[model samples]
Structure formats: structure tokens, C-alpha cells
Target: MAFNGKYELESQENFEQLMKALGLSDEVIKKYKDLGNIVEFVQNGNSFQTSYNYGSKVITNEFTIGQESEFVLFTGHRVKAFAKLEGENKLVITMEGMMAAMELSGDKMIETLTNGEITVKKIRKKI
Candidate 1:
């Protein structure tokens, strides 16, 4: 989704801050530190993922930041809707009320998503 220039920059900063707060590895932070172009973020249920290209290097990863984790930290937050991938797998979880839950902090939500319980697929970031 196309966003206003200001909104896009602010969102990028917000996402980057949230990632750092979650203690994402140095490698991940490095890839997104200067994100000035449009990037794609995909979501399924409570999980989310994204991919991007840094010059000639292509990077992609997926993590499940559940709604009850860090998602709630940013109230009134809405992800820009993008195209849905075909033939993607869905995750099955046994947590009670998982669907109805919302994350209280973006950092915690990111941590939960990276718990290795969810399968992540990488796609090329459209530069």
C-alpha cells in the first residue's frame, strides 16, 4: 500500500524501533536500518513477515508477532494491506483465545513471533 511520504517515513522508524526493542539480532537490524524505499509486509492471522533487497543482496524472513504481544503497544495501528501470496501454509496453535488476544507491546509480540513455533517463508522485496 502506498502511504503519504511522511507517514511512510514515520512508520519505518516506528517499525525499526520496535524491532530493536525486541532485541532482534544485529544482522536483522542492519538490513533495515536505513529503509527508505517501499517494503512489503505480509500477515496471516496473528503472524507477520517481510522481505527486502539491500543492493544486490536479497533478504527475507518471517516471524509471528501475535496480536496479544507487541501489536497492542501501538494503538490505532494498521498495516498497509498488500498482495496475498498463493499456496502459503497456515499455522496451527493450541493457545487459548489466541485469535482474540492483542499484544500489549510491540517488542513482546516480536519475541513471541520469533519463538520458532511458526514457519516463515522469505520472498523478494520489491524495490
Candidate 2:
């Protein structure tokens, strides 16, 4: 699978703004703003296990494509989400009021998370 690998955060845009829009406190944002993230994905057919490591915090979610499952967000909020594959290289997850789309391109994984008009984009290089 194209997504089965560990990726290190290369850069991010609007991270603090998006986190604030997501209701994160200034203290919490300051604690994690400069910390890099490592995301690992394990794919097996239609099922996938994804883990996002943010130094002191790690959030993991396991789900099958096109199925509704509970997922823990970076804010430590649990929500029901549905994930689906868009084409061959893009995976999109839809939550209650947010959407996350991750696309694999060569050795890079580009993730975009949108909640209303606020969006955060992170680029990760496979490591």
C-alpha cells in the first residue's frame, strides 16, 4: 500500500490558527506548536491503522474503508468518522464538522484538515 510507511512532518501552514479555531487553548497550542509530528500508516486491503505521533501525544485509529468508526482527533476529541478512498492515492475522512484529506505523492504525504473556513495543511516526507 502506498500509505504504509512512517512520515515525518516537513512543514505546516495555518497550524496555530486552525488549532485555535478547533477550540484549543493558547497554553495547549503553545505546548505543541513547535513540536514535529510523525505519522505512520499500516494498510491491509480495505482496513487501515493510522497513528499520529506528536512528541508527547499519539492518536491512533483503525477502520475499514467506507465504514463509520470512532476516531480520536489531535485535540483528544472522539468523534464518529467515515473514511473513503478517493482515486488510488487519496484517503478522505469525513467527521461531524470537519474533513481531512491525505494524499500520497512519491515520498510525501500531504494532509489537509478543514473545519468550516479554517484549514491546516501539513506536508510530511516519508522516512
Candidate 3:
């Protein structure tokens, strides 16, 4: 899927909507926004791994394309999600209540997330 890259967060837009959709409190959202976030994506054929860093804490999840897998999210919750490739540069992940689409172009990775009507966009640059 050509989704392999290590990226640093450049900006986040409408992230409050994402937090609300995830059922997180305002305090928790504030704490999360205060941390430095970094992301890494690895693709080994059909196997995919995505890792996130927040200061001293790190969360990693792995899945296979078109296959159902159970993984841990950044909020420390266990959930079942399916990962699938959309064309050459986009990967879509769908869970129980939310969906995420990640597209890469050049040295930038753009992630768009949605839960119901709420949508958030996060942009990252290669590091």
C-alpha cells in the first residue's frame, strides 16, 4: 500500500471533535493535546503496524489488510478494527464506532478520522 513512513505531527484540526467522538472528557483532551505526538507506519506486504509516541508513553498496533484484528488504541482500550488499502496511497481503518483514512503524498501523511458526523484531520511530515 506504500504506507510506510515515520512522521512527526505538524498540525491537527478539529481534534476536539475526534476526542468527543471517542467519549473523552475535556480534561483528558487537554492533557493529550499537551503532549508531543509522533507516528510511525510500517507495511510488510499485507501486515501493517502503526505506532504513536506521546512523550514517555508509546502505543503500537498491528493488523493485516482485509483481515479482522484486535488491537489496542492510544487510549488503552482494546477494540476490533479492520484495515484495508484504498488505492496506492490511502489506507482506511474501520472500527466499531469510528473510521480513519490515511493518505500519503510525497513526504507528508494526511490522516482524516470520522465518528458519525464528526471529522478531524491531522497532518504529519516525514521525519
Best by lDDT: 2
CA lDDT, candidate 1, residue 109: 19
Write model 1 residue lDDT over 1-127, tens digit each, in one string: 2210111222222444445555676787676565423334566554555444344544444445333222211222323222221223323222322221112122111111222233222221222
Could you give the C-alpha RMSD of every candidate to the true structure, in order shown?
13.7, 1.3, 1.4
lDDT of 3 by residue, 69-117 (tens): 9978767889999998888898999998889898988889899988988
For all candidates in order, the CA lDDT equals 0.33, 0.90, 0.85
What's model 1's overall lDDT?
Answer: 0.33
The true-versus-predicted C-alpha distance at residue 16 of model 2, in Å, is 0.9
Instruction: Score residue 112 of candidate 1 by CA lDDT.
Output: 18
Q: Which consecutive 10 residues in model 2 have the weakest lDDT in total?
A: 30-39
Candidate 3: residue pairs that collide? none
Looking at model 1, which ten-residue stretch has the lowest summed lDDT? Answer: 1-10
How accurate locally is residue 34 in candidate 2, as Cα lDDT from 0 to 100? 69
The deviation in Å at residue 69 for candidate 1 is 13
Flag the better candidate by lDDT, 1 or 2: 2
Off by over 4 Å in 1: 1-36, 66-127
